[model samples]
Every structure is written in C-alpha cells, then in structure tokens.
Target: MVEAARALFVREGYHATTLTAVADRAEVGHRTVYVRFGTKAALLRHVVDVAVAGDTAERAVAERDWYRAALTGRTLADRIEALAEGTAGLMERAADLFEVVLQAQATEPELAEAFQAGRADTRGLLRRFVESARTDGLLAETTDPAWQEETVALAGQAETYLLLRRTTGWAPEQYGAWLRRTLTHVLAAPLR
Candidate 1:
C-alpha cells in the first residue's frame, strides 16, 4: 500500500491522488487503506518517511553506513565528505517526493507539521556532527559551533541538491563531489 501510494503521489501528485486510486493500485480494499493509514495526510507522511529513509522502516538515517562513516571519520574533512555523499544519495531518491510534500504543506496541516518535524530532525543530526567535531578538535578556535551546525544543516538540504541536479544538469556524482568540496572549505578548520 505504501509503495502504491508513493507511486501515485509521484505521478499524479498529492491533490490528485485519491484513497480509492491507491487501493486500486495496491490491489487492496479501500477500507484496508483507511484502516491502515486513517487519512491521506497520514499516508503521505508515511510515504515521505519511507522515501527519506530509503525505503526501510527498520533502520534509521543514523544507522546507515554512509552516515556512520561521517560520524566515525578521522577528520572534519572526511566527515563532511561522507555526509555530502550520503545527502546526495538521499536527495536523488527523495527530492521529488519532498517537493510534493512541500507543495502540500499549505493545504495540509499534518504535512506542514511533518515538514517542520523533518527539518528539526535534520538540525539535530547536524548538531551531533558539530559537537563531535568540536570534541575531536577539528574545528578552528574561532569557529562558532552553533553557527557551523546551522550552516551544515542548511547546506545539506534537499532543495540545494535538487537545484543543482535538476536546473544545472549536474549528475549525482558531480553534485556530491561539489558538495563535499564546498562543505569542507566552508566548515573545516584551516590546515596547519
């Protein structure tokens, strides 16, 4: 049902997608969708969550290998590179659906809340990375950890990836490399 809804939402969009259509696509009863998801907004939220997490409900973003590499990297540059690669993969998979959700936010209160919640979650993850960098003495003495965290969070956003990939025709690899280099320059301490 989630797969069905995701495909429909991507092809037909949020406003045009109906519960009956989702049921038909999934080959399930209408009542099954209603009973499982309760509402279209709830179903959309599930779709977004699954997409952002790369189609797995079992593991979280932090548990992913790429994210783990970022957290466990030997230096801030390595960490930023790993983070950029991971974020590029995520944006490639979820950018379209995220745009759909963003568009629906004005009309759907639940989706609006979900969008904000997702941003907060991203911020929290960046904060953890910033704290780790500070602990490892990878940050410059003059660097403001809070400001760096916010900058990383904003730089890692899906919209930036979408813009570069979609509007500028950059491949995912190119985008990832650029992101890694840009973030390293922006967030890393000066080399001795």
Candidate 2:
C-alpha cells in the first residue's frame, strides 16, 4: 500500500493523487486506504518515512549502518565516501517524492510542516556529524561547525540533487562520485 501510494504520488503530483487511485493500485478496498492512512497528507508522509528509512522499521536513520559509517569509517576519505554514498542512496530512493513534497508544501500545511520537520531532522544529524568530524580533526579545525553542516546539507539536498540530475543528466552513481569529489576538495580536512 505504501509502495502503491509512493508510485502514484511520484507519477502524479500529490494533489492529483487520490485515495481511490492508491486503493486501486494496491488492490485493496477504498475504505482500507482511508482506514490505514487517514488522509493523503498522512499517506504521503508515511511514504516518505518508508523511503527515507529504506524500510518501515521503527529505527531512526542515524541508527542505520551507512549513516554510522559516515561517522566511524576507517579514514577521512572513507567517511566522506560513506556520507556521499549514503546521501546518494537516500536521494535515489526518494528524491522524486521529496520533489513532490517541495511542490505540495506551498499550499498544504501538513506537507509544509512535514517538510520542515524532515529538514530539521537532516540538519540535526548533520550538526552532530560536523561536530564529531571537527573534534576528530577530519574537518578543518578553524571552520565553523554551522558552516560545515550547512555546506554538507546543501550538497546533499533534494533540490541540488534534482537540479544537477536535470541539467547534467547524471545518473545516481555519477552524482555520488560528484558528491565525493566535491566534499573532498571543498572541505579540507586537517592533518590527523
């Protein structure tokens, strides 16, 4: 049901997608869709949650292995690769849905709230990462943590990913490489 809604939401914009359509796609009763997920906004949020987490597991993204690798990979470059690859994997799975959220946020309060909440979650995780990296001398010691966090956030953002994908026609793997190269060059790590 979540997958069906995700497909419909991405193929057809959020406003254009309906509970009935989701029900039909999922081959479930119309009431089942409503009873399962009260509103379209709620359903969309659920879909995003599943995509972001890569599953409906009740675990936070910070608990995920890839995210952990970003924090504790063998080397600075390895950590950077983990960050790039993890972000690329996430965007590949949900960038379209994120674009859908971006479009729908303008008029939908629920979606706007959800979108902001998601951003906050990303920033919070990034803040911790930058702090840890700085402490470990993986990032420039003199650089501001806020700057580092925001820079990484901007690079890993859906808007940036979508824009680059649209203009350069780069595939996900290509984007991941670009991210790795950009991070390695743009963020100078201090000598360990």
Candidate with the greatest lDDT versus the true structure: 2
Residue lDDT tens for model 1, 1-192? 988998999999999999999999999999999999999999998888788888765888888888888888998888887888888888777887888888899999999998888878887887787777778888776435667777777777766776786788987778888878776765665533
* Runs with alpha carbons beyond 4 Å of true place in candidate 2: 143-145, 189-192
lDDT of 2 by residue, 84-131 (tens): 888889888988899999989988899999888877788777667666
Quickly count the clashes in candidate 2.
0
For model 2, what is the C-alpha lDDT against the true structure?
0.85
- lDDT at position 151, candidate 2: 77
What are the models' TM-scores?
Answer: 0.89, 0.91
**What's model 2's lDDT at 56?**
87
Worst 10 residues of 2 by lDDT: 183-192
The alpha-carbon lDDT assigned to residue 41 of candidate 1 equals: 93
Stretches > 4 Å off in candidate 1? 189-192
